[model samples]
Target: MSNSSTGEIRIFDVNPALDRAALAEQFSRNRRIQIRDVLTDESARNLHGILARETPWGLAWHAAEDGPHNIRREDLATLSQDERVAIARKLDTAMRGTDYGFTYAQYPMLDAYLKKWSPGSPQDAVLELINDQPFLDLIREVSGIAELVKADAQATLYGPGHFLAQHDDSHVAEGWRLAYVLNLCNTDWRPEWGGYLNFYREDGDIEQGFRPRFNALNLFAVPQRHAVSYVPPFAPPERLAITGWFRDR
Candidate 1:
């Protein structure tokens, strides 16, 4: 199978490349690359729609009073989509800065975290995707990492007032080689709305940042300090994405 999108559930198609030299150079020198339209438009739309309604979210509570307070849902089940989103947004707003605060394990920010899905899990279309060979091939082609054997995927929902503090995805036990976020927001989303993916230098200065570009895949080598900035109250209710890592195992 070519790993292209099916009519029933559209998967993403890699962007057509006339010249891959730039992509290879970016990944090689910077250890990161952000590709637009990683998913087909229809596929992105369908996936976002499914996430908006189908995900069964639960509140993610961190250890400290100023710790993580976003809602998460790991168990997929049948439910009303609109109703769930409403509930998620309501809770997200209620917890912001009042009793709940942003205090990172080592950094600072507020954001929701979703339960991750492993391969072969039921009703998990996201995992069904990372397992596709074409997608793996695409990763290899761009990242220049030939030995990458597996991938992990999870759904992340960032509602208004939610954010992720700066942290490096580096635990020897986890074995994550590269981190990626498949953004599922509207294309017209504005920078002033917040929820940007910010990259930092070792000195703690921001080297660069990325808006939640719809249908885009932002991939970076593991252990880089980065964060998702807070989504302000005026922004849309939900910021959705499928985030995870490509592993060497």
Candidate 2:
């Protein structure tokens, strides 16, 4: 779909060459697979520009019993230097221990659409594209889950020091059927930079891990053990993506 006022910018066009049967076979064997170059070149570049330059980022984190905080960009800017440091320290402490914790930047796409935030922006266009018939059919074919009727999205950025602790997505009551990450990182992203999507074995070993690759779509059945690996201080500033779950309801 073209979102530009001049009608020249196409924002969410999926690649026409994807092999659905092959992807479905892979998913059937392992319940997860990453499709590279999932979007057309023009579309991917346009979407990346939207994430890197147009979106308003916010802080989303949880440290012990303190919070499952969703602080907007404006609110985040109001914090004192010491307050920012304290929040970082608390996140570090919680993550180091045997407890649930995460710290990352996000722009809730669905929420923004419903709230009329940034109307006509590329973010809203992308969300609408996700729920449109073509994209939904693609997801259904790859997952072999015909019941997936809708999706929710959040634009996420995992800059230096960000991480997500491991947890199984067992929210069955919420109708979550599959989890997807539409990676939008730079093509030059390196392994040492971290920010990998890792799946764990029962013995705590990493069963599999997928690096953040530009324009790649990673899909996995929900209720699985997984986490986003920490991005170290030395890593680059942007590990951007659109992430969320596909639901039956």
Candidate 3:
């Protein structure tokens, strides 16, 4: 529900008792992932505003089954007058620590995006604060298939020309029992753009795609192959989404 009054934002508060149980059951039985269009339109829109004013890099857009706001260091020059000013004033300070965000040299996650350009960045601190809610907490408690290691885990942000190859969440070097993507792109995402998230099952077949819709939460198991695909050449806005992994106790 997009309410134009709150500047095109709507907050869909989960009915704690019911929604949590539903989420737990869905994830336990599906064996893949569940896409929930839980947030209202207005809330999604307002999120776009806060995100635009906060991220370190300029926004680039892409669409696929799943997408993240890709903010590049160089794209800063292309920003509109207002956009540039917003970046300068609002993000200048916040961008400092978020520099390294997170890093892994083995896979060359987005080697093409920063190979020659960014020499060194914040090594590992790409993470965020999870919304304090019962539904999310309950899901963790019952999904006995996983152990909660980090509350707000942030792996890395996907910028233009950058992408993470496919691999199972639980199969990553560190091991992931479960996976969750908390979308923070905070923008209007169209389906055709191409940065959709690709998931795979144990059978080595591609699973479903999670469209980069704002405020949508994509939850699934993480023992098989899964990869994040980059958007096409022309897509303008970047993507912003957070990833979380559960460990086995």
Each prediction's RMSD over C-alphas, in Å, is: 7.2, 1.8, 12.3
Best by lDDT: 2
Write model 1 residue lDDT over 1-249, tens digit each, in one string: 235544456655655642456677788988887888776677778777766676555444342233444433432234379855754555455445343323111100112212333322222445655767778888877898887887776567676656666778886477788898888876477888788889999998999898887888889998898888878778875567777788887
Write one digit per residue (lDDT tens) for candidate 3, span 83-135: 64653343333324332111111111133223533332221212212323333
Q: Lowest summed lDDT over 10 consecutive residues: which window, candidate 3?
A: 100-109
Higher TM-score: candidate 1 or 3? 1
Which is superior by lDDT, 2 or 3?
2
Error of 3 at 215 (Å): 0.9
Candidate 2 residues lying further than 4 Å off, grouped into runs, are: 1-6
Instruction: List candidate 1 segments past 4 Å from native.
Output: 1-7, 17-19, 63-123
Q: Compose the digit string of candidate 2's lDDT tens values, residues 5-70.
A: 114787677789999999999999999999999888888888899899998999999988878898
| TM-scores for all predictions | 0.74, 0.95, 0.55
The candidates, ranked best first by lDDT, are 2, 1, 3
Better of 1 and 2 by TM-score: 2
The order by descending TM-score is 2, 1, 3
